[model samples]
Target chain A: MTLSPEQIIKLGDLAKLAVTEQEASTLAVQVDDVLKYIGRVNELETADSIGQWKDTVVNTNVWRADEVRAINEAERNELLASFPSREDDFAKTAPVFKR
Target chain B: MRANLTIEEVQNGLRAKEFSAVELTQWYQRQIKEKNPHLNAYLTLNEEALATASLVDKKISAGAKIGPLSGIPMAIKDVIVTQGIRTTAGSKILENYIPPYDATVVDKIKKQAGIILGKVNCDEFAMGSSNENSAFGPTRNSIAPDRVPGGSSGGSAVAVAADLCTYSLGTDTGGSVRQPAAFCGVVGLKPTYGRCSRYGLIAMASSFDQPGVLAKTVKDAAIVLESIAGPDRLDSSAKDKPLKKWAAEIDQDVRGMRVALPKQFLEEGLNTEVEKSVRLAAEKLTRAGAKVELVDWPLLEMALAIYYIIMPAEVSANLARFDGIRYGMTVGAEDLWSHYQQTRGQLLGPEVKRRILTGTYVLSAGYYDAYYKKADLAKKRMRQLFAQQWQKYQAVLSPTTPTTAFKIGEKTTDPMAMYLSDVYTVVANIIGAPGISVPGGTDSQKLPIGWQLMSAPWREDQMLRLAAVLEKE
Candidate 1:
């Protein structure tokens, strides 16, 4: 149940977070501690258990009329303005692939 | 001064023409200036507070009808986005992010003429049990300056307790609202999961997150809850039922109502003083005509383990949006992958990183069934168990926390120890039930202890009735 430093680094990579060697070392022990504590759940009987996807309170699907409604220009501009970097009327981002 | 007025008293004073909304806003603004420096409760202040209040005054002068929250100053946890105001969520990543729109609750409160005071501090992304995780530094408990205010709603609770605002809005993913309210000796109400719309709340654990209220009295909390709770087309998970008249039902009788005291919550590791106060509160409820009984809820013990699993899983998913491309801080790098790693690594705090990493691990390949799937099943079982108990008991009562507010830096190094602080409160969230934390009494340190009352889903009316009885006693 204990997480090793390598596993901690792997987790950080998967989570898209950078971990320094020092941080990975410290976090390895901390994550291991938490996993060991949470490991108690492993003892519970899950053989017949079915994973519940929806909340018990709001289990039904809600429907709305199929209609087209355009957002106001001002509102659309506000949303576009929230992007950190933007081209003319479009959000900009770093290059996904290099030529 | 206006700082000491309750929401009802404020409304009455406005109607009586004793003071104008502008004057009241100025008074609260002055109080924030005087107190917030030492407490660090408010991270941002609305510069237009006086203007907003004056508009309310003008409306009143025009003989326009106003809601209960008209002109009442309120603080919101930074996690709840405020249009045109910088909402940091106590993280450096979003330190400069100004939301383009108000959260659904914020929008509703504004429509009622509630004056926005400012955004209060909270743990980064509402992750930690103590406000110490705040990137801006920890908020001091108003009652005991050296102790930690239970968090991530610490600032909201402290604002209400210290009278910086008439009431404050907070979010309780676990015990963020209730625990801090207990620490600060105020009333914190966490309605059912979908009670308040989560349209613009900075998502942490999506399923467990709910907007809550921290107020000086049960009635004020009910008033705020009534204003904010209802269906919102923007939030698909929001309940479709009509909103209850909570303020109208606040004074209802609790006589002959059955309440349960789960024997598990009073076990070892619980501070003796907190245990005594909660038990005495139960006795007080009995005297107030409630039929109290001891009950066994075995599933309560598994709540913390399941929460850590499910909450982090959701956290990982929801937080993926902050991958440096959309908004917030974006550290430039050679590629998008490195951009995400560097921006999140350099910006997010350690606790947030820990949750994200652990969540990634649990939901990763080969381990999903053992951890995520199992936790989901356990959560469902816990809800079923709670429903069965509600068939007999009108509400379940326990200490809001295992102990009173701990000293600052006491549990910061030990993350597991800090996680245990929410043990008594998280079960309600897992079961998607309504819970309230009311001040029971003080511990030996004179730090306040809260007694919590949880009821079935959408049963906030009965839950508040029991809390009102306790408030009276």
Candidate 2:
């Protein structure tokens, strides 16, 4: 149940987080404690697992008409105003590749 | 012995012309001004609150019929978005972001002419059990300035407890609303999941997060619930369910109602004084003519484990949308990966990152079946266990939290200990049942203890009625 530093670093990358070495080391311990605690979920008997009963948390898909309605003006402006860098109507971001 | 004004009292006072809507708004504003410096309950003051109050006053002067929440000031949890106002969810990432649209609950409150008292503080992204994790600052318990207000809805409960606002809206993912309410000595009601629309709530754990109410009375909680709870086309999960005159109907006698007190809730980790208080509260219900029995529910012990897995899983996905490309604070970098990494790493707090990493680890390629699936199976068993319990008992009761509010810095460094504070409260979210916390007797330290009642899915009426019995004593 322990999280290795490598796994923590890999998780940081997978989560798109740039953790400092200090923070990663700290997370390694904290996450290990949490993982050990949640491992107790294995205490539930395997016979009564999801194999017998279907997971009920899933809801029926929401189907709707494929139509575009007019967006509220204030809402559109507020959203556009939050962009770190904007070009016309697009939310501009950094270059995806070095090339 | 409630000190704050309830909705009915506020309504009656307005109709009697004892105080104008403007005056009421000013009163709460003054209270907030004086107390919030030490309490840190309100993060932002609504600049338009007075204007809204004046509008209500003019309508009253014109002899126009007013809405249910007319001129009643309310502080909103920072997590629930209020249009044209900044909704930060107590995180640095959303510090400067103003919501484009009102959350459905906020919209419903506004439609009824409820005065907005502005947004209250919370744990960063509602991730922590203690409000100490709020990025701006932690909110102290109004009851005991030295102790923590149980969180991540600490500010919401504090506002209502300190009478900064008549009532406030909060969200309960694990124990956010009820735990804080218990610490501050108030009524907190978390309605059935999908009862309140989640359209604009800053997502924490989409499956567990529900906008709830913290008020001076269960009746007041019902009033807010009636105003906000309904299906929304905006969130399809908010299925069409029958709304009730809960405020009006909560007064019915509990002559033959069946209630069960889970034996494990009092076994260990529960403070003896709090345990005794909960047992006494159960006795009071029995005296009120309800049949109170002890029941065995072992799976309840594993709720926090299941919640830690499922909640963070959802949090990782929900928070993925906060990349710098769209909104909030962003740090510049040459490459996209570095851009995202630096933006979130710099802006988000440690607890946020901790959960995200844990979620990433659990849902990673090889571990998904072992961790996520196991938790889901546990959750299914929790649902089945409750469904069986409901066949015999109308409500299940427990102490809202293991102990009274801890000292502010006591558990700050220990995430596991903080997570254990949610042990008794996470089951409601796991099973999607409606639950509430009412003030029980206080501990020897005089910190307030909370009594909880949970019932079947969408069966809020049963729990509300049972809470009314507890409130009666």
Candidate 3:
């Protein structure tokens, strides 16, 4: 159940986070501890029928009218203004691809 | 004199002209200024609170009819967005983010003329058990300054306990509202999932997260629930049922009702005083003609393990939205990937990062079936087990937390120790049941211990009625 430093770094990368070497080492141990605890879930006997039972307990695929509603212009502007970088009513971001 | 009034009493006072709304708001504002430095309960006070109160006062003077919550001042947890206010969700990432629209519950409160006091501090993104996880600072327990206020809704609990506001709004994913209320000596209610709209709550574990109420009394919590609970087009999960009158049902007798006390919760790791107080509270219920029976529910023991896996998995998916391009913190970098890495890595706190990492690991390619899928099936089994219990028992009773509030920094270093504090409360969230924590009694240090009562889905009326019996005792 223990995680290696490389695994921790890989997880951070997958999660879109950057982990320092120190953090990776610390998180390696902590994540291992948490995973060890969560390993108890393996002891529980789960059946294939449980998936069908889950659907009975939960409601899904709720549908609403497919009608267009105008967005509040003021609210939309406010949301746009909240972006860290904005350009002409759109959120700006760092270049996705660099040559 | 105004500081100690309950929500009902506040309404009565307003109707009787005992105090104007503006005067009441001023009292709370003054109290916050005086007490908040030590408590760290409030992160940001609403600058327009006085103006809103004045408007309520004018309406009253003009003979206009006021809503049920008219002029009652209350604070909201930082996780719930408040328009025009800096809603940080107790994270450095959202330090400067101001929401443009109100959360559905906030809008409902405003329409009822509930005066907004401020946004209270919480654990970052409502992730931690203790308020210690807050990036700002830990909120001190109102009774004992050195002891930590149980969290992630610690500030909301403290505000109500200290009479800084009539009531406060908080969110409970696991034990955020109820655990803190147990520590701070107030009433906290986590309604059935989808009872209140989640339209503006900063998402935590989306499946478990629900808006909750922390108030001075059970009736006050019920009143707030009645005010905010209903169908909303904004939150698809919100139940489309006719709203029940929760406050009106508070006085209903619980005579002859059957309640189950799960034996598992009363076993190991439980504080002796907390156990004794909860048992005494059960005795009181029995004396009042309710049948209190001890039941063995071993499936309950697996709740915390299941929660850690499933909750983090959901947290990973929900928090993936916090990239640099959107509303939160941003760091300029040469590439988009580095922008995300630098912003989140630099801005999110340690506990949050841990959760994200664990979440990603479980949902990762190799471990998905072993961890995430198994946890989901376990959750389903747990739900069915609870349903069977509900058929026999009217409600379940347990200690809200394993122990009373631990001293500050006591359990901060040990994440597992902090996670164990929620063992008793997480079941309610996993099963999507409504639960409440009532101030049962106090320990040797006079720290409050709460007795928790939970009922089947959408049965908040029954849950609150049982809580009312405890409140009367």
Candidate 4:
């Protein structure tokens, strides 16, 4: 269950997160610990149990009534104002990957 | 004025000219202003409440049909998005953020003519068991100021218990609503998953998060529930259960009601006073003509473990939207990635960051099947056990929390200790069923303890009926 720094970095990237070196190191250790603790679940004898688990029964993707409206520019800006960075009235701007 | 009158009583009062909407709203506002300083229950006060009260008054004067909750003042949890009002979710990241749209419950609450008193405080991103995690500061228990008002819905529960507002809104995922309600000596209901819309309400665990209500009494709890429960198209997972005719069913006797008590719940960690109060409440119900039986559910023990895994996994995903780039307090940095990391690391509290990290670890690809999937399987096992129990018992009984409200910093440093507070509350969320926490009695410190009553899916009406029957005493 031991984890490496590179694996932690890969997971962080895929999850759209930016992790610090300290966090990555700490998480790698804790991840190893938690994995060792819960490892027993994999050996449970319920492999052949039917109807033991289920996907949620609920359905989805129903459309709604059509409507168009305008929001006040000032009010909208108030919401956008809390963000740390923006450019040209849009959220900006670092590439997801090193090019 | 009837100090403890229910929502229905208040409506009848308005009809009989006993009190005006303006007067009621003003009374509540005064209560908030006078009492909230000690409780720290409110984050914002509604300036337009009086204006809305005037409209309700005009309707009453013109002999128009008034909404059920017309002019009834209630507080919204700050996590719920309200149009043109700052919705902080008790985080510095959104400290001044104003949502452009109202959450579904907000729209429904407003439509019921429920006067918006203000927004109440909560845990940062609804991630903590006690109000201490809130950026605004810990909410004091209505009955005991020395202890925490249980959170992340602490303010909602305290506001109701303290009589600052007739009722208040709270979001429950893993017992945010119920545990606090228990601690503050109020009634809190976490409806069935998707029973209410998540539309404008911010996400914590999309699969488990549900907007619930807090009130001083069970009947009052039903009043808020009826106003907000229904199919909400905005939340794809929101169920289509039409709001039941609950008020009408409140009078139905629980003579033949079947109550199940899980024997495992009274285990080592449960407090003696909490167990005694819960047992007494159950005895009171049985004396009033209901059948009570001890039921065994082994899966119940694994609920907290599974909840910890599933909830944090969802937390990491749900909180991903909070990067400084789009819509919250963002700390600036030289580049985009650094900006996201710095803003979240700084803006989010310690408990929130802890979950985000833990969640990221479990949901990470290599670990997903072993941790996340295993927990999901355990969740299914618990749900099945619940379904089987419900077939035999109408509702399940347990202590809402293992203990009464702890001192503010008791478990603040240990994340696992804090997670233990939600032990009883998370089971309902895991099973996707409806549950309510009613004020049982006070502990030695005079802090309120809560007793939980759980019912099958879409069976809120039955549960409310039983709660009303018990509350009569």
Per-residue accuracy of model 1 over A1-99 as CA lDDT, tens digit each: 567888888898888899999999999998888888876777778666533434543456768877887999987887787777889988777777753
Q: In candidate 1, how many Å is residue B192 off?
A: 1.1
Q: Which parts of model 3 are misplaced by more than 4 Å?
A: A47-59, A65-67
Tens-digit lDDT string for candidate 1 (B1-473): 64568999999889888999998988888899999999999999988788889989998999999988989999999999999999999999998898888999999998888999999999999999889999999999999999999999999999999999999999999989999999999999999988889999999998899999999999999999989999898898888777788889888888999999999999978998999898898998999899999988777788899999999999988988897666787788877778888999999999999899889978998889788877887888788787788899999999999989999999988899999999999998899899999998788888999999999999999999999998885
lDDT of 1: 0.90
DockQ class, candidate 2:
medium
- Backbone clashes for every candidate come to 0, 0, 0, 0
lDDT of each: 0.90, 0.90, 0.91, 0.81
True lDDT of residue A94, candidate 2: 85
lDDT of 2 at B334: 91
List each candidate's DockQ score. 0.55, 0.75, 0.74, 0.35
Across residues B106-163, which tens digit of lDDT does each residue of candidate 3 receive? Answer: 9999987889999999999999988999999999999888898899999999999888
Per-prediction fnat values?
0.62, 0.83, 0.85, 0.36
Please write out the lDDT profile of model 2 over residues B124-198, one tens digit for every residue.
999887799999999999888999999999999999999999999999999899999999999999999999899
Candidate number with greatest lDDT: 3
Mind sharing the TM-score for model 3? 0.98
The list of candidate 4 runs beyond 4 A from truth reads A1-44, A49-88, A92-99, B1-5
Best by DockQ: 2
- Over B1-473, each residue of candidate 4 has an lDDT whose tens digit, in order, gives 55755677788889998999999888887788888898899998888899999999999999999878777888899999988778999999898787877998899878867799899999988888888989999898877788888889988988888888888899999999999999888889999997888888789998899999888778777877787877866677787766777777777888888999889888878999888888898898898798989877766777777888888889888888887666767676666677666677678776676677678878767778777878877777677677777887898889999999898788875566778788899998988899999878788878888889889989998888878766666
Backbone clash pairs for candidate 3 read none
Return the candidate ranking by DockQ, descending. 2, 3, 1, 4
